[model samples]
Target chain A: MQERSEPEAARGPRRGRGRRPTAEVRADVLDAAGALLLERGMGGFTIEAVAERAGVSKTTIYKWWPSKGALALDGYFHAVESVLAFPDSDDVEADLTAQLRAFVRILTGTPAGRVIAELIGQAQTDPELSAALLERYSDPRRELAVRRMRRAQTEGQLRPDVDPEVLVDQLWGACYHRLLMPSLPLVEEFATSLVANLLRGVRA
Target chain B: MQERSEPEAARGPRRGRGRRPTAEVRADVLDAAGALLLERGMGGFTIEAVAERAGVSKTTIYKWWPSKGALALDGYFHAVESVLAFPDSDDVEADLTAQLRAFVRILTGTPAGRVIAELIGQAQTDPELSAALLERYSDPRRELAVRRMRRAQTEGQLRPDVDPEVLVDQLWGACYHRLLMPSLPLVEEFATSLVANLLRGVRA
Candidate 1:
């Protein structure tokens, strides 16, 4: 495993004092941050702008997230977490299809996808930023799918011989291919066919 | 297709006079640019620095390429093109294995890979940069693989029913997945296995 830095969740609220900030404030800040990211691109985005747009103080924002990248990361995750809920079902085929389809929807269909693309771009040069993205955005999410596949393997829905990680890669690789290279359109049918073809090899 | 501003190749040799600069001068500039990219990274990279390093004027550099991005792109292709060559043989399996293994070697084993990663990140934020990357880096290269697959199909080595584009995506997507996320080591065995398994589905 590539060495991962401790995630932001490990370093929680700096200001854990009087009247803990409400969930509404969190939502408002994230909403504003997401909007600023899309409108200004990564270059024009700033903590102060998020503060102004969200109607929250910079101190409040800093209390939650250490830096602008961290704050934007929070907003990015907010956009992602809402869309990519974990899937658990006995019917492996149905479950995998739904999960992949939902993934494609958020990645291709939403403004959130653009934020992700920008973050991915930024992460390329910045090791700390890349580590943070992997820890927060990729790991927990990938783990959920890993567990689901393991359970399916245990139940004999998938080939025991096939490595779960490779299976995951097979399912996700094409979707990301479309996302990174936008020449080809990413319709729902792509996911359906990708899953169907990969399942032929992995299914018990 | 996103409208492409003319490429550097199209705008070559503006300083065409009595003593035209030798090909060695072109090679020197690209080498310097590639070195600067490795040493200082994308943020610190600039055309002026490349000009100073290459011992050429900014006007000289601009005479060949329209922008810094274009110059860096030339250097990047220089780094990559030297490494990746097309595979053509009567034996389809041997041919693909060689092609993919060489690809993985370049992507996993060189500074060009880092350049590619940085470019991918930059491409996410800049549409023009993204288009340049797609046009210059990805499309031409991917088309080679697609053509190879289509030829294999015509030769009755691959299944006629399978879409050549999907086949290309299946092969390249996994490589990109490894590049974008580096948890798993991309050994030669991975390429060999990926091609073997993918070919199983597509083989006649």
Candidate 2:
């Protein structure tokens, strides 16, 4: 995150301290933000530290994000999108079960899970961040799931009366419940059982 | 929550501050903690503020509760249990529907809901607080739900294969999803709809 943005190749012998390109600056800031967020956590994270580490001005970071929460949220969103994968196989249950296992694995075992938890924690208090996180992060992922579920419906694999929104909510809800409650474990087996039990109840 | 702490009546015209009874002190502390928690929320709340507002020493507050999070959590649990009721009618559906409606109503509308949200928000970070919240607050309520659902099983109203834990988790997960995501509305209609849809899936 303390960017190698210095571009050793460009530094040659003159070793100039000139401004980098706009895209590089943004990448550096987000990377610094992700590093700082994952390292120090939400409580200790700050925009100033990100600017210092990224070698970008606070004005430049603020020009794009508007606030510290927004920047941290951006970092979180970037991290989640990079790792999440969707299933596309013809079998709805296999596609769902496989993708869900992977999805839950990221949420339970990875830094991406931690970042989602942190962002969700703050989104409880900040309404704007809540909207930004959902619209930018949650909904797109959901649309992918919904598209697959509807495909299942058209293929006569899902119940005609099934509600995709509720269906997705139940799956993610269980995942989030496990994430939020330390008492509940979210292992791959539990994900498998949850999908089996829930889908058995709703499958066509 | 300000207790009647009737030493005031007993003290009569003197109305002296001479060492109130232990019960009175405890009640005052909890009331102050509740008031401060409801007003300032978890992030802004502190034991010192509760002590100052309650006219108790910081040592006294510390002696009763181990940490700021614990005291705040106790206040939240007290507030929630006071308003929450258990369902128990011969008709399990009617009983569950009414109680679920009330439970979700509290979750969606009252200060109790906000406190639950705050505790959950922090539980994402603090494992100790997460354990305390689940053990003290969530488990007892869940036990009550399990009890009623078991009775439903006995009466052959719910599927015998239905796992009570999973059944409860789905209901709670959906409610929590609503609580965590402000973009989604948590109205009475939604609660009713959620219960109807989920129960249909799990019914005998």
After superposition on all C-alphas, the RMSD of every candidate to the true structure, in Å, is 9.1, 5.2
Q: How far does residue A33 in candidate 2 sit from its true spot (Å)?
A: 5.7
What local lDDT does model 2 show for residue A202? 23
DockQ of 1: 0.25
| lDDT (10s digit) by residue, model 1, range A1-204 | 011134525424522433445786777788878767656656778999887666567888888887777788777766566566656667887888888899888776666567677777788888887777777666666677788888887888776765666556666776777788776777777877776665553111
Predicted candidate 1 versus true structure: per-residue lDDT over B1-204, tens digit per residue: 011134535435532432445685687788878777756656767999887666667888888887777777777776566556666788777888888888888776656567777888788878888787777767877787888878888888776766666656666777776677665666777777666666543111
The digit string of per-residue lDDT tens for model 2 on A34-89 reads: 77776666776799988777766688888889778788877765655555566677
Badly placed stretches (over 4 Å) of model 1 are: A1-17, A20-57, A201-204, B1-61, B201-204
Candidate 2 residue pairs in clash (backbone atoms < 3 Å): none
DockQ, candidate 2, comes to 0.31
